[model samples]
Target: MDVRFRYSDHLVGLIEDAAVAATRIATAPVSSLAAEALRAKRDAGRLSARLDASPLDDATADAVDAGSWARPAEERWLDEAAGEGWLGEPAGRRLDEALGGRVTGEPAGDAAAAQPADGWATALKLDGMPTQQVAAVEYANLLACYDAESELTDQLFEAPMTVLTTLHGLICRGLVAAEILGRPRRTIQAVHDGAQGRVIFNTPDPRVVPRLLDGLVDWLGATGPAGSAGLPTLVVAGVVHERLLEWQPFEAGNGRLARAAARLVLRARGLDPAAVAVPERTLAADPGGYHNEVAATVHRRGDLGPWLEW
Candidate 1:
């Protein structure tokens, strides 16, 4: 159940170019104020694309659109985080902020009177807003906070699972049943292409899920910046994305979590620490290509050059 992949010289060269671009995107001579604003826009675009990638009914999409009124609150939250120097703090403190309801949103209709103390309980004050809207808004906030964490540390590599579960927990807060929240799947899992109406692949046995994840984290730490021989950040990001998608650890939100984690890798590995990169938008733009690449990797048993190249 160890992590595995193969790539060519062409892939290596392409990833090298990507690594340079990623590094420059964050390090270029942009003012901090402008960078923060640009990051906010990037987050919104990425979050919107991610939601669009999921299978949503028209009603849900419309509801989520109505919920977009919370954008002001989201901006305010990001502003506060940036101003308060919350970016490089430990991931646990960020998780605490999420668990404390600070990252949740109130109903858009009630936004004008929103108080700092309202927190998640105000989500119950959604009035007529669909709960789905709350989920979407919460996701937007959680992802922004996650991406804003720019500091890389050895702790992250040593216990990558902590970050993954924390993210899964944030994502599934109200979307999934409580018992399964943040927990690895205990039963068999299969990935189905609802758009194409076919099974893409079956996951490893649940018993192996934990071991496979351990292998992934170990590989990540070994080949990532924490290790002596680090691969290109973009290459590591691609492997993180595909492997997490292949594992199917959580019953829900696996795709979202994988993308978020991949972006984290980009940030942690010095490619896009500012996290303005919207790679998910590229994947979301062509869902068919993304799925096909993943399916091909699954069938080929960790042959990831095609996915990486794509």
Candidate 2:
């Protein structure tokens, strides 16, 4: 007997209803709503990527290498920024001020005075842990790194690896959180053992990877016009996240990779990539729903609305 389930229509209707409800709420400024949505998308993407255990295809591999290869020069500039106190201690103080003393202990009397002005700089190191926790830490670390730097160019080269690694981590974290597997890293292994829906899309083909990276870079570099122009940013992030999942890229970490890539895009577009203070944590709290949303998109050939709405 062959059995198949159809949940796309049901899920899409539910998402549309929620979006309608949100639209009816107190009129939210377009810029503000776009910013928040971008952040949430990034968070979800990071979580998803960190959990998958897939490997990189040749195209993706080249992109990752190119991005990483480009980093040394940027790193030197970053080091200079740090040395000039542009992105070092002074920047830290500025961040604290901008965060409204959230980073520091005192209130910043004005937004302008709080603007990290130079740039935000931070270094994050995650200790070893079982695969799942590692995934979460990776996502958390990426958020920290992205938030620290004010200029996207500084992270241009490292973007691909950052995206892939973070995605791997998030998937692991999600599996552990859901108790779908006792060990975080072992979720893929367990799935394989059970023959429970093979990841179905794991490869390092040279054909698709480069296109993905280039598309991501182009989106990051594209500019928006004045007054409430964050829609493009959110749309690009949503597209990238969905695309990576559709590509599958790795044997086990595709979901996590997609999420991490989304976070990178958000940060590159000058948006906060952290999930800590936003609605993302609330969304992630429901692992089953989160997985279902992603699955819906993947199965539907990347329809995006259901995943993006959730």
Candidate 3:
């Protein structure tokens, strides 16, 4: 069944206000601050991604031994897809570059030089080179996100599973085992409220995830092409964010994926085409409030009115 969601009069008004703002933003002329604002927004996104990986602490949750995690997943499909020129030229090039050293079966550049005692530490800065080697998986995530943004065409929106899996594969490349990359989580998953130190909720059985995702795709279809039509941009963005989080489709990197997907919705929908607005900035500012709102929405059985308003 499609997840339940309710719309209120207040929610409708809020969406309308957001729509008006989106129109103004879409029509506004480029300003000197656009570049700077975009840069700031990107930085915020990176920080938010890091925080999502490690909500309560700066320590990396997905960190593994450098030896085990250093070698990229040498998947044949990746190279084959790259050779087939899938998802356009830029995306293909990025895919090739992401698997460059591994595909050649030789160390390349700094990845060769940085011989740490342990495995790579992804999600943030490597404070000490002696202990933590930078993971190429992180670089893959950067390229993947950039490519996803560029490839957000109507066709992509029509069948978004490709982009979603690509994002998951790149984001969780070395951080997880190769077999699980681009795969829906098979095991049970539980998310805890870091601040409260209590289990907020447990994800549904993995068997149902595919069905839930299909429902999400259907909802996206109703939202229209590029996920920008029919509904207000912010409403679409919010639903995308919450549903992904609620589903917990991947074993890891779900938080980052959710945020990234929401950003794509915003950009594709013209709410933040210039990427000036930093939703993460506000989210990171009020971590407690953010968690509370999400928890509240989930507790309400996916009634997203409060979440959209928030």
Candidate 4:
């Protein structure tokens, strides 16, 4: 059996659904925060364009590469809050630590981490293998999509799916590097696993996939402004994510796609989607409970309060 075809079919369904949702949301009203976020996004876009057009000095390039365009506004806001004593000292300290020594620069040790930090290098030596190459390819693809100006309908499904593929690929590579999975077994198992599942959410009929996705897109676009007002963009994004996950749309990778969709919504809201301010990681800490929450929602076909609250 050709597992590639199965994987492709599953992904096609998922992509179609996502594309439809994005289209709906694209026409929705822009929330106040979304407006602010749009401005920031525009600024970042302009900066990126300028960088691409003209070469910069190493220092300047380094700063931009460190994501300065995205950092300054948030950093300043946090600094002001801390300066006013609005943020507790401990909280400020923790933030600083997480951000590394410089609030405006790349996190501390990222450079070293990129090139085998001391302990990591020692581990590699002991294992008699090369240092782990953190998957830069995935990051590159994400950055490319972020920089693109295409409409949601044009790239929605592709962007998120690319991210998912990159994520899984990175995970597999990391596992192999750690000697948890040998190369040959990795190749065979990944192919088999990717191809085997046909568990699509909501409807089994492939034809419904495109229509469902389009409905979501229309809904999102229509409600964009109104949705932005009553709820924080992050919360709205979370809602959308949960809804899609419940709908399932694809046989495999629904969870990953939902998470990616959440990230996209966050970006649309003008926030760093990857920022870990929310305790989402905490929910993932208990894997079984997390799955149960999702299962409950799927079974009940109603409120996802449990999952959302977590």
Write the candidate numbers in order of decreasing TM-score. 1, 3, 2, 4
**How would you encode candidate 1's per-residue C-alpha lDDT over 13-104 as one tens digit per residue?**
88778777765776666777367646554454345435434333445444444554454243232243344343245544554364443222
Supply candidate 3's per-residue lDDT for 275: 62
Each candidate: RMSD: 10.1, 17.2, 9.9, 19.1
lDDT (Cα, tens digit) per residue for candidate 3, span 171-217: 66555655455555555666777766677766666657767776676
For model 3, the stretches where C-alpha displacement exceeds 4 angstroms are 1-13, 27-34, 55-86, 89-144, 223-229
How many angstroms is residue 285 displaced in model 3 relative to the true structure, after the best TM-score fit?
Answer: 1.5
Q: After superposition, how far is residue 292 of candidate 4 from its true place, in Å?
A: 2.0
TM-score per candidate, in order?
0.69, 0.39, 0.69, 0.36
Runs with alpha carbons beyond 4 Å of true place in candidate 4: 1-205, 224-230, 250-252, 271-280
Cα lDDT of all candidates, in order?
Answer: 0.58, 0.39, 0.59, 0.36
Model 4, residue 96: C-alpha shift (Å): 41
* Cα displacement (Å) at residue 256, model 1: 0.7
Q: Which residue pairs collide in model 3, if any?
A: 65-119, 66-118, 66-119, 66-120
Comparing 1 with 4 on TM-score, the higher-scoring candidate is 1
lDDT of 2 by residue, 214-308 (tens): 45445544444311123444555566666655544333344544555565555554443332223335544774555556566656755666666
- Candidate 2, residue 124: lDDT: 16
Give the winner by lDDT: 3
Reference-based TM-score, model 2? 0.39
